[model samples]
Target: MQLPVETTDSINKISELRNTNLQNILKKEIDKNALWKGLVAKNLMAIGIVDLTDMSNIKYAGINDNLMMYAASLPKIAVLLASMDAIENGELEDTKEIRKDMRLMISKSNNAATTRMIDRVGYEKIEAVLRAPKHKLYDEETGGGLWVGKRYGGGGDTNREPLKNLSHAATTMQVCSFYYQLVMGNLISDERSKEMLEIMKDPALHHKFVNTLDKIAPRAKIYRKSGSWRNYHSDSALVWGPNRRYIIVALIDNDFGEKIIRDLVVPLERVMKKARNLEKETKI
Candidate 1:
């Protein structure tokens, strides 16, 4: 999403402090609580959050934020962006079939649909977009952000992300950026990014973050993608609330990652709400 000139300037004001108020609150809860302590001990958890109320006044908070983990289905969002990019560039058709595939691939976590979309988008092309100077959603310096090197449900070993050599991979910082940029209209053209986000709306499979967030903010609107395989689970979303809009990305690499991700919802909900109230709350 294309952020306004001043909004872009605000994104530059990001602060990185582990002991900031929001960080302190979240770290205290995740560290002291049994629900999240085990994952932290295993070095299997990472998270990033961006307050998007003013775009320019946004602040970021994170823990293990740069750690890369097997992203599960979260990386499918990369393909979603790439597909829209192709459509915008006139390299692909914007057909009903393509739209359905994109929607299902995200909303339902459809592996087959993701494979089709990825094949059309091409792994190299997706990388190019992520690594592009403009987006930098995935950066070598940060050990990479979002990547899909293989088709979902296995196969295409030749395409796994180079940083971790995993079929799918992500970093908390990057996924947060993905949603942040998507919200800023920087992932693709403003119009195409809106269409892409619309495809992710009203998610059909609600199990991870969305499920837990629902427990607190029952009516919150979320556009998210989630994935779980073996012990790893990852979820990233742009969440909408009565007072603000924000992005939260969590990457976990343990058997209990989903539970840990879910457990974070309450504490995060509190911190996020308080943080936004500190700013001038802007309802999306």
Candidate 2:
């Protein structure tokens, strides 16, 4: 099924969705946990959330959203977008293997499949797509967003991001913008966004955000992608349900980052719920 559009001319980009009350509620929720607050103080964890319950009046809240960190497989999303762009432009051949690999690369976070897809599209192509003005998924001027400068596996030259030299890196802000633009059907095209979302739907690995979400919102349709390597853990998802239409992105660097992300769901949900009530109060 096609995703719904959530943009007005005045608020086309995700950057335009910032809401002060939502930001305050989000901060209050995060600070309630001493350990989480400590991590925020240390710049080891970053979270970005968007309340899409009312698509016409989106609300955004974030903490250290632009603090770029090594994001491991999360940047594979850059490869995914580049591949889609190539296929659309007829710069790369669309094949059955490519389609299967795309699903595996995203749904299972398959390194071998990701590496092959990267080789098919090339790092230069991915870089161009990100740096392109239309997408700007990675921009040095904006603290450097999603980046894939090296192959997922081994045996290739490393083209690290210029700002941080991270082989693969991302910031919660950029990731949040990604899902925002994606669902808005502005990623390549509406049809392409749907295809990408199809690949991301119902992720295979159930951990971090998905692990908790599966229990709390069993019927929610979750389009997600996540990554983990050593102490670096990251998760991003556009969750669509009755009253839970929102986007959540977290990037953390700590031994307990995985658990931290899983634990963040309920509190963030509370923030969204309260934001909704605050909107209602203003209307009444």
Worst 10 residues of 1 by lDDT: 1-10
| Tens-digit lDDT track of model 1 for 115-219 | 998888888888888788777777778777788878886666457766778778888887877777666666666676678778877799778888777776666
lDDT of 1: 0.76
Model 1, position 145, has a per-residue lDDT of: 78
After superposing candidate 2, which stretches have Cα over 4 Å from the reference? 5-11
- The residue ranges of model 1 lying beyond 4 angstroms of the native Cα positions read 1-19, 53-56, 274-284
TM-score of each: 0.87, 0.97
Best by lDDT: 2
Error of 2 at 120 (Å): 0.6
Once model 2 is optimally superposed onto the true structure by TM-score, how far is the C-alpha of residue 98 displaced, in angstroms?
Answer: 0.2
Scanning candidate 2 in windows of ten residues, the lowest lDDT window is: 2-11
Model 2 global lDDT (CA atoms, 0 to 1): 0.89
